[model samples]
Target: MENYKIPDNLAVSEEGFLFLPATGESFTLNEIGKIVIGLLKNGSSIEEIIERLTEEFDVDEHTAEKDVNDFLTQLKNFRLVEEI
Candidate 1:
């Protein structure tokens, strides 16, 4: 699992709206996305996030890992997170 950092200029609303101060771009996140982003911002490792997801969402480990990986890839593609 890799560590990632959310950009310092990014702002996340309580309702899961993500805004980039640098580019003035905004995006919305689903509930799961919100949780993942929150955990990532808190410095949680990918594995730790998987564990938390499984415990919180009634999802299996495999599903959680896959989902997290996919979400991380999307974040990377969007330039919202950087590998640390």
Candidate 2:
């Protein structure tokens, strides 16, 4: 699976707040979204992300995969991340 990366123009806060300097846009992420973003930025693969989520959140593999894919889709839609 391809890895994802956050743009340098996107700024993230410890409290799950996101900002895009160039666009003057800001977003707030839920706990899971924040966790996913951190993992993505740290160079985690999609499978690795799903595994980590399952380990941390008491979620099953299928659900973890769905959620991770959905979140990544949303981030892509928002231009927050680019696939590599």
Candidate 3:
């Protein structure tokens, strides 16, 4: 476990909309990715995050763990998150 930063130029609207820059290319997020980002924005720990997702999404602990780890790895590779 590491912490990550939410991209400053992007945000979620009050209405729960994803806001990306007009000049930036649009990137669609999947269901799990959306939940991960939501928890990350809320300052949840990696372990807490996986726990939350597992409970909220009706996913098994093992599946949630694997998905979150893989998702974080991809986000890091894309520069969407930097270790903190």
TM-score of each: 0.96, 0.94, 0.74
Q: Residue-wise lDDT of candidate 3 within 6-74, one digit each (tens)?
A: 677765554445555744544557766777787788778789988988788888999988888898888
RMSD of each: 0.7, 0.9, 2.7
Once superposed on the true structure, which residue ranges of model 1 sit more than 4 Å away at CA? Answer: none
Q: Compared with the true structure, what per-residue lDDT tens digits does model 1 show for residues 7-38?
A: 88899998999999988989999999999999
State in Å the error of residue 18, model 1: 0.5
After superposing candidate 2, which stretches have Cα over 4 Å from the reference?
none
- Deviation (Å) of 22 in candidate 1: 1.0
- Clash count of each predicted structure: 0, 0, 0
| Backbone clashes, candidate 3 | 0
Clashing pairs in 3: none
| TM-score, cand. 2 | 0.94
Q: What is the C-alpha lDDT of each candidate?
A: 0.93, 0.89, 0.74
Provide the lowest-lDDT 10-residue window in model 2. 1-10
User: Between the candidate structures 2 and 3, which one is better when assessed by TM-score?
Assistant: 2
Residue 46 error, candidate 2, Å: 1.1
